[model samples]
Target: MSGSKKTYDTDTVVFGAGTAVIAAAIAAAKEGQETYLIEINNQIGGVMAASPGMMLGAGYPMKTSIGGFFKDYVQRMYNHTPPLARRRLSTLENLGEEVVYDPDYAIFL
Candidate 1:
């Protein structure tokens, strides 16, 4: 190995490409910041992508309305051509609301 080193500069560097981190990166980019997302796997979405057919729980326990990136993300899913996601109650009682979505569609979105 050579003694040379490479460094990159970015306004925002989000570790892991999970749903939350992806959202954070998008938010930063929208704010005109240079953002970078790093993920170990070839794909993003973390556990969501790793486990196919997984549903995202929103407004858990509180069941309150959620806004910001999460809300927008869900809206995008619903607004897709065939509707990539749907709002539903969790099978487990205390889990509150969930967003059931197609993994493939979610990744591309």
Candidate 2:
């Protein structure tokens, strides 16, 4: 990296789109500061993909116990994917409910 070539006149550049990274990006951007998110990989979902189960988890940011953007993101995932078949999965239902399988679900999901 060359210190000589400055990217922007404003002050902050966020790295990655991980949960923590997105939080920081949203916070910084909300504050009116110049913020940028740089993702290393083509994929942006981070650790969520590996875990399979999308949980708001403990200590997430939300008025209710669930987190904000994270919850919305997961819901969008379920909304798009078809319900699983047999009402059972190799793992627990990602949606945490019994539903038919969407054949192309995970592939496109």
Candidate 3:
């Protein structure tokens, strides 16, 4: 780390960790700005620690030709996750409805 160019009281400093803070760091780093994302916890993801699995918001997304950071992230998930990992499950236990998946996420725990 070079101390010559560095300065205190940064242009951007996001406290608390989670997807939001991580996103902020990515945005700042992509923008070529000096940024710092602080997390009280030792790990990066906060709520995601409790709630695993991809966010199903907007449903199965329509594929796009042009890719960005977020798109690339999702693409990595889709590609890296094996087909065998995709299993359906009964949701009557907790979700109060039918659900599908490779296995109940709780199985790991």
Candidate 4:
């Protein structure tokens, strides 16, 4: 063993940079905790970064849905998309608790 390896002393250590993990890290940091988000992949969003047609299902009433960071990300995508596409997504949203967004934007966000 050598002293080359570094160490981190954090109040919260998130093991992934996926949507949920990222949200957890954000929440921890917001609570004034020192947080570390570790991601094995070179990119973030996990499968979502590649899955362009990915839509997250909340499996509940939209009124009681948990927004958090994920919601903010989705809202950001809405601004990136065109009006016609926004209209389409709006139609879909009327039917279910899901959000459709571009994958490339996911990585950028």
Candidate 5:
């Protein structure tokens, strides 16, 4: 059933295009590595695209923003023309900060 095997010359090959996977790909690319991302779905985001009203708990129990790619992503959402996201206190006690964003806008971003 299979024919020729295609090979990719990449320093990093990340399977899946989930939030974490995307971040890893981006980080690898940023480090001057030739990174490739493979996703089963047509879209980039995995659970993020599937689940509506999904909240990203960036600054959870520690109550501090986790810097790096996540921080940049949050900043981008905040800086969007229409402001795609907003910080909120988690409903659960001591859960710390969470980001609630428009799923459509999130996908676009």
Candidate 6:
């Protein structure tokens, strides 16, 4: 293992490690597919991570919905121990459900 770079062989390779890509990779792997996620940046979340905060608003009034990884993420945020993280679930602040999280948490999720 001198100069050769590590390699991964997967049945499915999802580019980018954004929320959507992560969700897709999870879905694919769940279906028994060998899945891999690749991102150029050392950090994940892409533009979402760089932004100050993220908005999880409803596009269709109360009808807007989320499932899979998204739902799980919201649940995780809701369960976060810090008051700040918990506050993100409720404080509208002229905006709806905006979450301010540490960028390092992106990889954790």
The number of the candidate with the highest TM-score is: 5
Report backbone clashes per prediction. 0, 5, 4, 0, 0, 0
- Scored by lDDT, model 5 comes in at 0.77
Q: Over all chains combined, what TM-score does candidate 6 have?
A: 0.67
TM-score, every prediction: 0.80, 0.48, 0.52, 0.70, 0.83, 0.67
lDDT of 3 at 72: 49
Per-model C-alpha RMSD: 2.5, 6.6, 8.3, 3.9, 2.3, 4.0
Candidates 4 and 5: which is better by lDDT?
5
Expressed as tens digits, the lDDT of each residue in 1-109 for candidate 2 is 7568655666678887666687687778878988878888876645643444433333334313344654444455556534323323324333333323333343233
Q: How does residue 23 of candidate 5 score in lDDT?
A: 90
What range of 10 consecutive residues in model 2 has the weakest lDDT sum? 84-93
lDDT of each: 0.77, 0.51, 0.49, 0.66, 0.77, 0.68
CA lDDT, candidate 5, residue 48: 70
Local error of candidate 3 at 47, Å?
Answer: 1.8
Model 6: residue 13 alpha-carbon error in angstroms: 1.0
Predictions ranked by TM-score, top down?
5, 1, 4, 6, 3, 2
Q: 2-109, model 3: which lDDT tens digit per residue?
A: 667955776688898665577677788789888888777666565544544433322324422234554444444445435212323333333221212232332221
lDDT of model 6 at residue 85?
Answer: 40
Q: Relative to the unseen true structure, what is the C-alpha lDDT of residue 73 in candidate 1, on a scale of 0 to 100? A: 78
Q: Ten residues in a row with the worst lDDT in model 1?
A: 52-61
**Better-scoring candidate (TM-score), 2 or 5:** 5
